[model samples]
Target: MARQLAVALTGAPGPAHRVTLSEVVAQASALAVSGTRTLLGISGAPGAGKSTVVEAILAELGPRAAWVPMDGFHLDNGVLEGLGRRGRKGAWDTFDVEGYVALLQRVRDLPAADAVVYAPALDRSLETAVAAAIPVPAEASLVLTEGNYLLHDAGGWEQVRPLLDQVWFLEVPEQERVRRLLGRRTQDGEALEQARAWVHDVNQVNAGLVLADAHRADLRLRLTTRGDDSAGGSGR
Candidate 1:
C-alpha cells in the first residue's frame, strides 16, 4: 500500500487544526483499562512524514498519551565533534543507546499515578538537547515514541524491540522522500548544491539502512506524496 492508496481506501480522517486529542486519549484509555502501559515504536525512512503522522496522533489522542522521541537522546554536536562524528550527525552511532534504554525502562516501570516525568528533546538548529520538552505524566497510558533508529540493529537498539508493544514503520517512495529532504535542507539555508550533496551522501545512505530495517516492524505503512496505505508482512 502507498500513500495514495491509503488516502483513497482507508478513509482515515484528515489532520485536525491542533493535534488529535481524542484518539490519543482513547488508545491510552484502552491500554490503561487493560492495566498495561503501551510503548509504541514509530520508525520511517527519511522524509517519510513520521513527524507529521505522530503529531496528528498525539493531537487526536491528547493527554492520554505522551511522547519520548529517540531524538532527545542525540549526542550533542560538541560531543559528536569531539568524537569526529559531526559529519554523520544522524547516523545510528550518534545517539546515546544506553540512555535511551534507560528511559524506555522507566516508561515501562513507572507507577501510573505519579506526577510527570520530564523528557529531553532535540534542538535541530543548535543540534543539542533541550531539557524537558516532553512530559510523560503517570496518567499517560500510551507512549508514542518515534525515530529512525527504533528499528535499527546497531549499538544496543536491538534491546528496544522487546520493550515495545507495537511498532509502525512508514515507507515513502524513494524519489519523493529525496525531494522532501532536499527541499528541507534548502529551506534551512544550505546552498542548493550543498543540500543536494547532503541528501545524496548523508540522508540517502542512512535511509537505505532504515528501509532495510522496516520489514522488522509489526506493520508497514506506505506513505506516498499524496497519502498512506498500510500492509502487514513477516520479518525476515
Candidate 2:
C-alpha cells in the first residue's frame, strides 16, 4: 500500500513525495474500512497545517474517525510556572508524555473493546486541557492524532512512534509558518512585539526539533495554498 501511494504522488526521487489533500483523504478512508482499529498520526512543526490536513480528513471520513491531539497532554500553566518553564510552554518537556502514551495504548485497543474511549482535548481559548472531552467510539476504526512531537525522539517521546500505524510530516515555507504563528498570537490579544519574541524564542526552538526529525516520517507533505485555504499538496 505504501509503495502504491508513492506511485500515486508526483515527484522526483527524494526523501518526500508530493500528494494532494484528496489523495491523503482517500488513504485515510481506506484505513477506516480496514476491519480493525488503525492509528494515523499527522506530525509537523508549529504552524505547519497539521490541524488543517486532519480537519480535511475528518470531513471526509466523518464518524468513522476520531481526532486526538497531543496538545491535550500539556502541563498546566501553574505547573510550568513552578518549574520555571512557563516561558517555553510548548517545548518537548512541557507535556505529559507518559500519560499521552498510555492514552494511545488504550485507544489502540479499541478493536477488541466495547466501551467508548474518552480522550482529553486542548481548549485553545482557555489554554488548558479538558479531561475526557473527546470520545472515540468502538465503531471508529481509524483514530487520527496530530501534534508537534509525534515524530520527535527522546525524553520518553521515543515511545510514541511505535504505537502509530503510519505518520506523515507536514511542511510549509518557514516564512509562511512564522507568519501564521505570529497572526495566531496577535489574534489572541498578544502584542505584536511580544508575539514575535515568542515565535523566535519559543516556537522556533520547537520547530527546529520537529524539522530535524522529518526523515522519520512515513510520508512528508506540503500543502498548496489557494487564496486563504489549502488547495492540495506540492513537492519541494
Candidate 3:
C-alpha cells in the first residue's frame, strides 16, 4: 500500500512529497479492505475544511464510505432559544454528544448483513437537525465523521477520541479561517459587521478550544484552501 502525503515530490519544493486530493482518497479507500471497519476522523476548528475533506473522501469511495457528521446531533434551535444559547449555536454544549457517540457505536457493532441504520443530518439552511436523513448500508466499511470537537476533551468529549481507527486535524490560516467563517455567517443574511462580530465573539472562542488540542491528532494537515462547493482553492 502506498502512503499518501500532501506535498509534491518534484514540481515546487525539494525533499517534499506533495500529494494530491486523489492520492489521499486512494489511501483512505484502501482502508476499507483492512478486515475491520475503519472509522477515520477529521477534526479541526470551524471553517477549517473538515466537511470538504469528507466530501472529497465520500466522492472517492461512495457506498464503501459513509459520513456521520457531529453537526447532525446539534440541539434544536428552540432548545437553544429556551436555554438562552441561541446566540452561540455551534458550541459544544449546543450539541448532543452522547447521542452522537451512541450512533457511532451502532455503526461499529452492526454488520453489513443487518438493515441499514439511519443517521440524522444538519439542515444548515433551516438551522435545524433533520432526523434519519442518511442511511448506513450494511456494506459500508468506512465511516468518515467530522466536526469541531472529535478531539475535544471537555464534558466527556475525550471519550470520542478512542473510538476511531485514525484521526486527522485540519489546519487553515487564521485569517483565511476568519474570512470563510464570516462568509458563512453572512450567507444566512447577517450583515458584514455582524458576521465578523459573531466570528470573533462566538466562533473564535470555539476555535481556540479546537486549536489547543490539535497536536493530539494522529496527523495534522494544513490545507491550501477551503475546498467545499461554496469555497475552492489548491489544497496541500
Candidate 4:
C-alpha cells in the first residue's frame, strides 16, 4: 500500500512557504494507525525545526509513538576531543556511525519484552552527550527518529537509509535557520558573539551538507510553520 502523508512548512519566509501544525499531525496519525512497524526518519539542517516537528508529532501521537533522537548517538566530548573534532561536533564524522547503525538495526527487529534500549542525548549547556538519556520501550508501534544524518550517504550513514520505512527531508530557508540556531546557542548559554560566529561558520556549512542530500528522502517537508498543501500523492 502507498504511504499516506502530508508535507507542510511552518515559520515560512513568506505566505508561499507556510506549513501548519495540523498538516503534520494528520500525516503522522495516518502512519500511526496504519498497523505496520512505521519508522519515520525526519531530517533537516541545523535549526530546521526538526526537534520541534518531532516533538509536535510525539505530542499528537502520545503513548502510541516513541521517539529516538539521533543526537543521543553523538560521540562523547572526550572522543571528539581526542580526535580534535570537538569544534565540529555535529558533523556526521563526529558521530559513532557504527553504533547508530547498530541501534537502527536493533530497532528494526522490533523485539518483544526485551530490555529497554538506551539512547544518547546532547546536553546543550555542557556541549556534551549524556549517556542513556532516552529509553525506547519494547511496545512502541511507531519509531520516530530525527537527525541531520538520516539522509547522509557519506561514511556509515548510508547504512541507516534502508532501515527507515519512510524518510522525510526538511527544507528551511538559510537565514531563518541561522537566526534560530544562534538563538538556540544563546539559550544553551553561549555568548551572543560566539553563537553568531558558530552559526555563520560552523552550522551553516553543516546545513549545506545536509541540504545536498535532500533528494534522497522519500518525502520532502518544507519546514515553514504554514504547512505543505500540495496534492501530490505519497511517495512509493
Candidate number achieving the greatest lDDT relative to the actual structure: 2
List the RMSD of every prediction in angstroms: 7.4, 3.8, 5.1, 6.3
Lowest-lDDT window of 10 residues in candidate 1?
227-236
| Cα lDDT of model 4 by residue, 169-211, tens digit | 7666666667677777787688999998887787878888998
Q: Candidate 3 residues 1-236, lDDT tens each?
A: 13434222112222212234555577677777787788999888988778777888998888889888899999998999999999998888999999998898888887768668888999978979999998887788898899989988888787888888787777776777887888777777999998889999999999998888886777666544234322343211
C-alpha TM-score for every candidate: 0.81, 0.90, 0.87, 0.85
Candidate 1 per-residue lDDT over residues 107-155, each given as its tens digit: 8888867567778898878769898898898887788888888888868
Error of 3 at 99 (Å): 0.5
Write out the backbone clash pairs for model 2: none
- Give the Å shift of residue 198 in candidate 4: 1.0
Q: Is candidate 1 or candidate 2 better by TM-score?
A: 2
State the RMSD for candidate 2: 3.8
Clashes of each: 18, 0, 7, 21
Q: Where in model 2 is the C-alpha error above 4 Å?
A: 1-14, 225-236
Q: After superposing candidate 3, which stretches have Cα over 4 Å from the reference?
A: 1-19, 225-236
Better of 2 and 3 by lDDT: 2
